[model samples]
Every structure is written in structure tokens, then in C-alpha cells.
Target: MSQWMTLFQKEVLEMWRNFKWIWVPLTFILLGVSEPLTSYYLPQIMKSVGGLPEGAIFEIPKPTAGAVLASGLSQYSTIGALVIVLGTMGIIAGERKSGVAAMILVKPVSYFSFITSKWAGSLLLVWISLFIGYISTWYYTGQLFDWVPIGEFFQSFVLYGLWLTVILTVTVFFSAALLSPGMAGFISLALALIISILSGALSNLLEWSPSQLTSYAGVLLTGGELPSDTMPAILIALLLIVILLWLSVFLFKKKELAA
Candidate 1:
């Protein structure tokens, strides 16, 4: 308990010292602004595009801030995913690279604390950034069109949260198990894409697979019907998160850390 607490504090302090501070929030903010801006202006943008042939009619969805925001949630979520994954790449990689772990290995700090602090810290950074993106999307979306479809909102965010949970666990596990941070991040992304492809290839087990986190979420977030059956999909995603997180911990514990 003491070790975990100490490591947590150290992790927090170190993160603060090294962090650029504004960038995390700014990433979400930029996405937030981009969402509504794109949604509201897309029609005009299309109209402005060069050389629409005479009598060629292009229909643009009338802008509603709420609809724009919901769309933003879907679009900006990709940015959140990038933020989470890349932040994870640096968590363990930095310690191994910077001699930070070498010095700590001499002290009483356990490998568990060292790795666990990183897991916790990286998760904190990802979740907080995701939340900021979510809120900004909502606020700007509301301001742009003022009317939101309540059902779409619920369905979208629930899927978003579940997807985030799965990605966070996958990234953390790979970051711990892989030989380097960049490899970990890229390998994890590849693993995710592979799962998606396999799920499509198999086609029958799509509902139980993690790919639903992306596809099913995209459907609801884009103002489509929310299937009542998605609950089971979310449950499977949650189970995967639990199992992978433990796998990460077990691998870290067994690794031959000098400390």
C-alpha cells in the first residue's frame, strides 16, 4: 500500500514536471473546434468546391449544433484514441531510456510500484484527455445547432466510453510487454487493426468481438438506431479489459527487473 501510494505521488509529480501542460487539453480543444467548424461549414465548403456542373444538385444536411456535436463525437474520438496510444508509448519507454529506472532500481522501490505507477499515470492522462474531448464536442455541438437527439447522445457516449476502456487496457499491456515504447504502441495499434480485420473475415462473431467498439459506436454516434443488443458486446469488451490488464501486470512482475 505504502509503495503504491509513494509511486503514485512520484508518478504524478514527475508527469507534471515533464509535461507540456497545455498540449493535452489543446489536442481535445482543437478537435472540439474542428468538429463543429466542419459540420457547420461542410455544405458551404462543398458549394465552394470548384466546378459543380450545371443541374448537378448536391444536398447537404442542414446544420444543427446538436447534430454537429454528435458527429464531432464520432470524428474527434479518433483524436482521443491517438492521444491515449501515443501517451502510453512514452510511459515505460522513457523510464527505460532516461536512466530514471536505473537510479530507482538502487532504491527500495519495487518493480511493481515502478511499473504500476506508469500504468496508472498513463491511464490518467488518456482518460482525462478523452473526457475533455467529449465535453468540448458536446459544448460546441450544442452551441452550433442547439438541438440534440437525446437517444443518439446516450448511445454514442456509452459506446465511446467502452471503446476507450478496451483501448486503454490493450495499450497498457503492450507497453509493458514489448521491448520498446514505440514498438509497444505500434504493435498494439496493429493488434487492434488485426482484430478488426479478423472479425470481418470471420463475420459471424462480430457482435462478441471488440471491433464492435468501433463499428457499433460509429453507428450510434452518427445518429443511427441504438441496438438494445449492444449490451452484450460492451460486456465482452469489459472482460477483455480485465483479462489484458492482469496479463500486463503478470508479465511486468515476472520480467527480470534489476530492482
Candidate 2:
């Protein structure tokens, strides 16, 4: 307990010194504000463009705060992929590059603490940002659209939080397996991109993948119920998080940190 606490403190220090303090907060805040703002303004812009040319066959949902918030939050599909992939890009790999891992090893910090702290810090940052963005978007959405049902929106927000945790776990796991942050970042990017593409191909077959997770959130935001059929996918997400976090520990233990 004490060791983990110490790791947490040390991790916070490292994160601050490395400039993540600015990066994480700014990213989430911007991400948060964008959703509501876009949703609020898009309808007016389209009207100025000429009100759908006097009755196109398609119907646009009345622009509301929830609509905007959902649109903005959907940006997370891209934002999240970029943020997590970059966050863990050089974690262990950087230590290997700079020879800091060896010096840290000589100190009382075990590789376990080192790896654990890195993840703990990153995860903490991710969780905080997500929560902030969630709250802000919720507030703005309500103001812009109408009365967003606070209770139901909160439900979807919490579910999105659960979804994020799983994605982060997979990213960190792959990052831990690598030799450098560059490699880790590439792998993470490849993983995210490939999965996204694959999700389209296997929408019917692989609806449980992270790719589908984003679409599911969009549906839920638009008043779709959590899919009873997706119990398997949701469970897979939980199981994968456990597996990834454990794999990160295992890989770090054998990781030839000197290499």
C-alpha cells in the first residue's frame, strides 16, 4: 500500500514535469466544449446554407443541446484514439532510450513500481479528463438543447467511462510489450486504425470490438437502450481490461529495460 502510494506521488511528479498536466486537461476541456458548441451552432449554419433546399427527402433531427453534445462527444472516437495512443507511446520506451530505466533500477524503485506508476498516472489522467468532459458536456448540452434528462445522460456517461477504461487497458498492454515509445505508438495506432476498419467489415460479426463501442455510445445518447444482445461485448471489454493490465505487469517484469 505504501509502495503504491509512493509510486502514485512519484508518478504525479513525473507527469507534471513532463508537461502532461497541461496536455491532458487542455485536451479534455477542448474536447468537452466542442461538442455542445457544435451542436448548438450547426443547425443555424445549415439554415443559412438555405434550409435543406425547400424540403429534401431527409429529415434533420431538431438541433438540441443533447444533439450537439452527442455530435461533439462523438469526436472522442477520434480524440480518444489519438490521446491514449500518444499518452503511452513512450512510457517504457523512453526509459530504454534515455538509460533512465537502469538508474531507476539501481534506486529502490522496482520495475514493478515503475511500470505500475506509469500506468496508474496515465489512467488517472484519462479518468479525470473523461469525467470533466462528461460533466461539462452534460451541462452545456442541457442549456443548448433543452432539458436533457440528467439521470439518463449520467447513465450513458458512466457507461462511456467504462468503455474508455477497456480501451486504455488494451493500449497500455501493447505499449508495455515494446522496445521504444516510437514502436509502442505505432503499434497502438495500427491497432486502433485496424480495429476501426475491421469493425466496419465485421459489424455483424465483431460488434463487441472497441470500434462498435463508439457507435453504441452514440446510440445510447440518441435514446437507444443499452443492448441486451451486447452483454457479450460488454463482458469482453471488462475481461480485456483485466488481461491487458496484467499483461503490462508481466511484460514489464521481463522487459530487459536496458534494451
Candidate 3:
């Protein structure tokens, strides 16, 4: 426990030194605020820059608040996820390359403690960034559009956060197991993309996929009936995260000790 705490502190300090603590949440916050702000004033923005010919009449319908929030979340699903993957792709790989992981392992520390500390640090960043972004989006969406029900808002937020957690866990696993950060990032992102595509393609057959979390989030935001299978999907995702974390620790220990 003490070793884990010390390693966790080192991870936190590393993040601060890298300015991840500043820029990551800021990126998310900007995404959240910009999405709704742009959506609310899109017509005006289009008129200003669209370069319409004389007296062109454009009839654009305003979207509901739910639609606006959903749009923002879609951005989160793509661009936001991409940014996070790229940022964290090197967490374990870079340390190994720099001999940091070897030095840490040479101490009286368990591989579980080292990996868990890294996971905790990464999760802290992910959660903080998402929370700031989501809250900002919710507030702006309520002001520009109608208010999303608080119950639904939090439900969707938590669900979407799980999707992100899954992404981070996969990244960590690859980072620890792979030699190249670029390859790790590519593989992790590819897997995530495949999962998302498969979830949509096989929705009827695969009711317990982690990708369903994003769909369930959209449903919550849009006031649709909550899918009955949501709990099963959540359980499956949590199990997958645990499995990945354990794999990362095991692989890191074996590979690092052999070095």
C-alpha cells in the first residue's frame, strides 16, 4: 500500500510536469463549451460566413436541447477519445524505454502496485477532464436549449464515462505489453474502433458490448426508453477492464524482469 501510494504520487507529479493536468481538462472543457455555443448560434454563424448571394432565404430549424447535447457527445466520442488515446499511449511504453520502469521494479515493489498506480493516475486525469467537459456542456446546453433532466443527465454522464474508462484500460494494457508506443496507440485505437463498429453492426446479437454504453448514453440524453440490457453491458465492460488491468500487470512484470 505504501509503495503504491509513493508510485501514485510520482505518476501524479509526472503528469503535472508534463502539463497534462492543465491542458487535458482544458481541452475537454473547451470541447464541451464550444459544442453547444456553436450549435446554438450556427445559423448566425453560417449567415456571417456562408457568403450567400443577394437576399437568399435560408430556413434552418433550431435543434432541441437534447439534440444539441447529443451532438456534443458525438464529438466527445470521436475527437475527444482520439485526443485521450494519443495523450496516454506512451504511459508505460515511454517509461520502459527510458529505464524508469526497470528502476522502479528494481525496488521492493510489486508489479501490481506499479501498474495500479499508473492506472489510478490515468483514471484521475480521464475522470477530471470528462467531468469538467460534461458539466460545461450541460450548463451551456441548458442555457441555449431546454434543460435535460438531471437524472438522465447524470446517468448518461456516468455511462459515457465508463466507455472512456474502457478506452484507457485498453491503452494501458497495450502500453505495458508492447515495445512501441505508436504501435500500442494504433492497436488500441483500432480495437476501440472495431468494437464501436461491431456494437452497431451486431447490436441484436451482442447486447452486452461496452460500445452499448455510448448508445445507452445517447438514449438517456434523448429521453428515450432506457435499454433493458444496459446493466448487462455495464457488467461486461467492468469485467473486461479488470481483465485488461491484470494482463497489463502480468505482462509488464514478466517482460521487465527478463530485461
| C-alpha local distance difference test of each model | 0.69, 0.71, 0.89
Q: Return the number of clashes found in candidate 3.
A: 0
Which residue pairs clash within candidate 1? 64-145, 65-144, 65-145
Q: TM-score for each prediction?
A: 0.81, 0.84, 0.96
The total number of steric clashes, by the backbone 3 Å criterion, in model 1 comes to 3
- After the best TM-score superposition of candidate 2, give how far the Cα of residue 186 lies from its true spot, in angstroms: 1.7
Compose the digit string of candidate 3's lDDT tens values, residues 1-259. Answer: 7888999999999999999999999999999999899988888888888778888987679888887887788777887788778988999998899888888788788999989899999999998899899889989999988888887778888888899999999999999999899999999999999999998999998888988898888877776567999999999999999999999999998998787
Residue 19 accuracy (lDDT) in model 3? 95
Worst 10 residues of 3 by lDDT: 217-226
> What's model 2's lDDT at 84?
71
Encode model 2's per-residue lDDT on 137-161: one tens digit a residue.
Answer: 7777777676667765766665566
**Candidates 2 and 3 compared by lDDT, better number:** 3
Per-candidate clash tally = 3, 4, 0
**Winner by lDDT:** 3
